[model samples]
Target: MKLVFVHDGPIFEDKDGQYYEYSYHGLYERYKYLADEITFIMRVYPVEKDTKGTKLPAEIKVINVPNFKSPSSYFLKKRIAEKNIEKQIRETDYAVLRESSCAKIALKYCKKYNKPYIYECVGCIWDGLWNHSLLGKLMAPSSFIIEKKIIKNAPYVYYVTDQFLQRRYPTKGKSIGCSNVVIDKVDESVLKKRLDKISGYHVDNKIKIGTAAALDVRYKGQEYVIKAIKKLVEQGYDLEYYLAGGNRKQSTFLKDLAVSLGVEKRVIFCGSLDAAEMPHFYDSLDIYIQPSKQEGLPRSVIEAMSRGCPVLGTKIAGIPELIEQKCLFKKGSVSAVTNSIVYILHSDLEKISIYNFQKAKKYTKEILADRRRHFYDQFLEEYRY
Candidate 1:
């Protein structure tokens, strides 16, 4: 059977120096392993393929729909994406969507073409937006209505965040847990011994706590990390902070904050790196963190855990699921986050990091493939599609 995945854009969002988009690549990585016959109905855009260029699997197909404009004109562009998407679906056995806009279009195609479609949404976008502005809170009711409609309509509904599903709707989808949690940690090519030795770097030393995400101030909790770093410095902890991802806007703001904290030498702004090369950055960490106020199964957490890095993060949206019993604090509390980091850092975290890596095994590419295939199998068995 043929399967098609729809997305807002073909490439991830790039800020001044940091690239912050997550859901698309994470989902693509997971789904690419599961489905043999697939088509990418994406918003074609320009991107940098490494100097060596990209190598895509033969099972995947690309079909760009130019109707993708900015969020402001989504309705008009959506119609265009939907217009051609319907044509592609005529031969496909199944269609999957990443978010609400795509879900609505996929919903329509399923209704019109008599094809079975699934909503592969990660979590509640409306609630995530509520972290950024009052507008998101205002939009939540409509988002709820639309989410409910999409969930009820789909033959299969898979989510990336279990907390989101449980809080917003009943847990009745085929593969009910967080569908995929991506981390660029396990590259069999690299020597495992290098990553396995976490104690050599962090034990009673001037540790560097790192986080990789777009410099955007709102969603990423960059400010909170900086504030926590300042608090740690005040407590006489010899440490430097690595703020790896940020664009011009975010970098400028953070640079100023670092100077204001008078810890300018301690904070480093290492701009965006190619997605494939992120594993190197993950390997160098003494302590890893992401204090995001809201997240959908953070890929960074998965990556850090893969390197056997003990992650200290906020207990937000889907994050608590992966960091289950790891290290966490109340969301937005710099003091709480600082304490958690200090506690984790003082101990010999090599064994803890090993445990973290072992836990991450459950969400591997092979595991995701099995889950997706079985989800399709169960749905088909229940109703011959």
Candidate 2:
């Protein structure tokens, strides 16, 4: 079957000439497994210098729409992009739109042509705009309206996490709960290496709390972690925060904020780690924190859990569903995070680790793939009508 995937993240051909759809490459890999042909209807852009991307699979076609990195660029280039998306969708057997700003046009064309399509609900635009800049906030209302309409009218809607999305957007058709992030069983050697390192560290030693997320999105609440760490240190606890993932420029603002909060020396900004190297990073942490103000579900928290790292996340979106209520704090709350960290420091970590690891198993690639296979079988049958 030929499937059209509509989203904004651009596909790039790296210096080595390997095709990649940025972070969405893994998701596309799963698509390549199920569909004989895949057409990605997304904004296309050039890869940055000195950087590379994950290679895409063989059975894929990329339809380059106008690349709009920000909402400011949308108005000028939207029409031409929409025309291209419409033309591409016409050739595909079905469309699967991963909810994004660029999806509005493709969704319109799909309806106009009476084409069968599914909505991949992976985020909440309303919550996403809460801490975003002026442009992001301005686009929220339209995005929210468009999202609701698509969810309501689409033949099927697949939510990345059902905890918050299904509650927020009630759909008439099939609503399958699935995560796009693929989790695999960690290697025994990797787990043992992490356990050995973890065993050597004690509570009295420098405690490491880590978060793996992009720094540019400010709403990930790195500042809150800094504040909480400052408070913890003041209470005579030796705390260090390792922020993994993000660029040097993105780290600059967080570093300045850490300095202002009097926790600069304690905060370590480890720029982005490769996928294989991420296991070692997660292994080195005593605890993982997801203080994001918005999310569909955080893949980072789940990954950390898979590595037996105790997780503390804000009670928002799908986080509460993954972590226990006792381990959760309100989003952007410094005092709440401070208290949660203190609680974690005193709690039965072994028990927490076991529980988290078991919970994470539910999101493994094998289970998710089975669910997708079932969903697609029905989708293909329905598309014929």
Candidate 3:
């Protein structure tokens, strides 16, 4: 079978003609058995000097579209992109659409061509856009309405969050909850080391707090954590903050923000780390916080949990499903973040680490792979008939 996979995320191509994507490392591998030939339809850009991502397999085909910088740019390039996407959809045997603006366009062609497709509803478009910026806020409502309608009508839908997304965008057709995050394995030693670190922690020792997310997106809420660090420092608590992910430009912007906020010394920018290096990054941290104002069952939180690092995140989307209610704080509230950190510090850190480690085991690669395969097997069976 020939499959056309569509997503709005940009893919980068190096001078050597190699393609790279930040979050798509093992994603295409899942469909290897389902599709005889796979073509990815996404925006393609030249690789930046400081950019980091997993290299794409040479066997996979890519159909590049313009990387629109804004709504106006998207509009300017819409006609040409639509013509190309329509042709691909018409030629493809099946479609797998990851929720995005580009996916919305592809869906129209899929229907027009009578192509069978599955929808991957990863995050809430409303929260994602509303929390993004002034322009995104203005686009949020209409985009939400469009995406909700898209999901509602999809014959097969897979949501990353168990209940949050399903409830918010209830579908009348067949659906299942499955996270895209796939933990290769959880080492027993990781939990033991975390427990030992927690037990050895002292009030006088500087607590290390870290978050792994792209710095370019403000909705990831790294600034809120920086504010919390400043407040905690004012209260005489020893603390250090580490931020991972982003290009050179985004890093400089954040570094400037840290300097202005008087937490430059406490905040460390680690730039972007490869997938293999992420486990070590989580291990080095005393606490992992996902301060995102928007998310769809954040992979970083689960990765952190696998390393037995105690986590704190906002009480939004699928976050509550991952951690105990006590660890959650209000989104975008610096004071609430400040209080949550203090509460976790005063609570039983060892117990939290153990709980997180055990919870992470549920998301191991073997378990999720089985679920995904079952879904795709059913999809292929239906398509074949």
Candidate 4:
């Protein structure tokens, strides 16, 4: 079977020369084992012109989604490009795909050509833009109409969480269940080196509360963790926080927030590290805190658990379904989030470690990959009509 994946996730450039968006690292790792021939059609933006992917597993194709931005021509050039890509899809069997942005073009072609495709929805874009102030009253209804039309057209739509399933999207066709594809193990040598570097930074017998996420705290709930960190400090606990993320500007804003709380020196902002830096950061921490009210099964929490760092997260969306522990707080409750962190910090590490270790294995890449292979095979067969 010829398997093709289309995604708009961030690209990864490591010391090794691999090329593709590494967001679904676990999924792709598993794809290595499952796909006989895999092609990843991605939007390689201007920023990634010089960068390549990690030292990825073999037998994969990195095909760039054609660019279509000419200010004088408005969207005419982009429209032409989309039409070309759509025609290409019409001529071939593109198995798996993400239903966002330009994939709509390919999806239209797939339907016209009677080719099978899977629509993967990580989140509702309309909800996302609204949450981030990118959505307006006019855009809301338009966004709804657009999403409704595209979703209804899909033969199969997959979501990383249940939010999209229990609501709109997959209005027709098979609404396949989903899971977050993160936490494929990294090179232990690279993992150890990253941790050793972090260890040399600062540690003074304080309970280390660590988090690595995109710097947007409003949606990410990193801000809530900051506020909770402040409360913890007030309670006479020596709190040391290491927040790592991609945006350097967010690091500056968080530093300011920390100063306002008088814990500026207490919070450490390790500017974005490579993908290899993730596992060690998760493992080195005493506790991992995620106060996010909005997310589709965060890879951060999964990685933290996989590395044996007890996690405290809001029981929102698919999280309560995935996390195999009592370490959850009700969404939007500041006090509850704070208390969960304290519980993990004060609890016996041994008991928590055993439970967390067993649960983390449930989200390993191998397991997720096997599930994906089954889903892809079934979807292609079921939707081929």
Best by lDDT: 3
- lDDT per residue for candidate 2 within 30-116, as digits (tens), equals 766546788877766565553344556766777778875557886667777877887877777678888885677778888888778
Clashes of 4: 2
Worst 10 residues of 4 by lDDT: 46-55
- Each candidate structure's TM-score, on Cα atoms with residue i matched to residue i, is 0.81, 0.91, 0.97, 0.78
Better of 2 and 3 by TM-score: 3
The digit string of per-residue lDDT tens for model 3 on 39-61 reads 99999888888775788888789
- Per-residue alpha-carbon lDDT of model 4 for 1-385, expressed as tens digits? 5566766544553445454443655455544443466766656543333333344455666556655534676488567657656655764555566755567666767777877777777766555555465434347667767877777866667777656344656557667565765655433443344345344433235778887777755666676777778898887778888887745555667778888988878788876655686766776677787776666667777777666666777776556755555788876666787788777666665556556556667776667666766776776566444
Q: Could you tell me which residue pairs clash in candidate 3?
A: none
Per-candidate local distance difference test: 0.68, 0.80, 0.89, 0.64
Stretches of model 1 off by over 4 angstroms after superposition: 10-37, 48-59, 65-78, 161-164, 171-173, 182-198, 201-204, 246-250, 324-326, 380-385
Residue 172 shift from truth in candidate 1, angstroms: 4.7
Q: What is candidate 2's TM-score against the reference?
A: 0.91
Alpha carbon deviation, residue 331, candidate 3 (Å): 0.5
Q: What are the per-model C-alpha RMSD values against the true structure?
A: 4.6, 2.4, 1.4, 5.3
